[model samples]
Target: MDKEITIYDIAKGVGFSPTTVSRALNDHPAVNKKTKQRIYDIAAQMGYRSNLFASNLRRQHTNTIGVIVPILNSNFQSSVMAGMEKVANEAGYNLIISQSLGTMEKEIANAKTMYNSRVDGLLVSLSHDSESIEHFEPFFKKGIPVIFYDRVAEHKQSTSIVIDNVQAAYKATTHLIEQGCRNIVHITGNLKINVYTDRLKGFKYALVDNDLPYKKASVIATDLTEEAGIKAAEQILKMDPRPDGIFVANDFCAVNCMKALKQAGIAIPDDIAVVGFNNDPITRVVEPNLTTIDYPGYEMGEVAARNLTNYLDALSDVNITNTVTLRSDLIVRESSLKKKLKK
Candidate 1:
């Protein structure tokens, strides 16, 4: 059997001491970037495996972070995970990821399991129906850093990383209005979630600002799943004097809804201009590419992971109330253009 490679092997191969190799592998900023790159390359080539778990035991830390999200099968969530993994790897931390499948009961169970497993910190995106952070109270009691992203919640003990959901939604709705839409329908996620609730606020704010009637019947709330999008489309189709525009809470749902609308012979941006949130890849693939807000999921994940790791390492202090809100903007596309542009 091949010998398990260590920092010593990498050190020798890269002409650096084991301490230097170790520091480089851990991404200590003191190490010059060029040297760190060289050491990392050599370590990979020598098949050196980090003694992460053993070192964690010595330091009284699990050297692992638990990440819980609403579900695993979302383009935005997947991007967030990718960014988190990139940061975690560089920091020499392992991630224990679990999905609650959009249920609060499952989220509570996952939280319990993470607590028992002794994760040093946690990153979370709340499930659709999660109203409180009680399930994560144990982590707060233990002084474990917990960071929330996307579907975040308000808590005095934890920091949150998110985008300006209300402004983003307002921007989307206003753009649709600018393109000559009056009767706009909003298809959103469960109101229990922060992201959806904020978007709903933005939608109403936009309508009131434009002197348009704020109709409670115009808002359709659901699980934000593809199936839910199709169902929302049905509800819209049934409306008296069908809506001339739509502002969906997410791209995945928005794309599916658009497909359903198209199947029903609705001409996009003509019969009904539409705007969505989260610039997922599917936004561009749909027949008339979806107009959406660039929610910065990956950047939000990176910020959350980086903050948690920094706090764990004592490299930075995080004030729980002063949350990090990333930038978001609308990207106009053919789907929301009701008026033809001058050629």
Candidate 2:
């Protein structure tokens, strides 16, 4: 194995002292532009990569933000990560990203790792089973900025950036009602999550507002995976009075559920209309494009990162009790349009 290149190598190669080499590498104002460029060119030629961990220890700033997401494999999360990387890169900060696989235990372990790494700030979207902000208490005690987005909790010391889940779900449910759907099924994930709970509230509220009976049995809480979607569809088929509409928590499950229903001799819209959340790309690829909530996942990520970085830079103050709610609206598509589109 080749020896790891260090500043000493660049310093010797460029005939400069270690102090001068360090200042130039760090872009210190004391270093002349010409000298700095020369050092940079020499450093590149010598294959020297600065020890960021040691540098961070001296400055007490990592210039790195830590991000903990529930899962990395979803279209929504992918878009969110893109937005975060864009803003973080533009701000001269790097991100250390980790995933929790939707489990609270893994999320707790991830939190511990981030804390030990001393990330300048943290952005987290809680796991499905995460009941409280206890795991993030260390960050709070240290006065480190922590921002939650998408699936968030009500912590007195952290801000949450999210779309109004209740309103978005209500809109989706109302659209189904307008489509003449009286009996509807609500498919969702763990209700322990704020997003799912709020959506459940909206679903119940919409039913009651429309003078429709809200039955607890109508709500199916599952993992919201493709397989779970199929199982939910099979369960729906066994119901005493078949539901005319379904408002699933996410597009992945909704699309799969729609497919299962269609296979079971159910005609979408003509029989059971369906609506989903996150307006994922698969929603469009489905035979009848899925009607869903257009969640601004990328924008949510951008806002979360910008807010955290601003706080870290002392350019803005975050109100822990405050929430940055982005715009989210229902996108009507063929799958949920039981009524004829008026010309």
What is every candidate's alpha-carbon RMSD to the true fold?
A: 12.2, 10.3
Candidate 1 structure quality by residue, lDDT tens digits, 1-343: 9998888888889899998987777655568999998987877777665533243343369889999998787888889999999998899899999999888888987887677667899999998778788989988887888998988888888888888888988999999889989999999887878888899999999999999999999999887788998999999999999999999998888998999999999999899998988999988899899999998888988898999888888888646555898999999999998787422
Q: In model 1, how large is the Cα lDDT of residue 31? A: 83
* lDDT tens per residue, model 2, 65-138: 99999999889998999999999999989999999998888898788767666788999999988877798997
Which ranges of candidate 2 are over 4 A from the true structure? 1-59, 318-321, 341-343
Clashes of 2: 0
Candidate 1 pairs with clashing backbones: none
Worst 10 residues of 2 by lDDT: 50-59
Query: How high a TM-score does candidate 2 get?
Result: 0.82
Candidate 2: C-alpha lDDT: 0.89
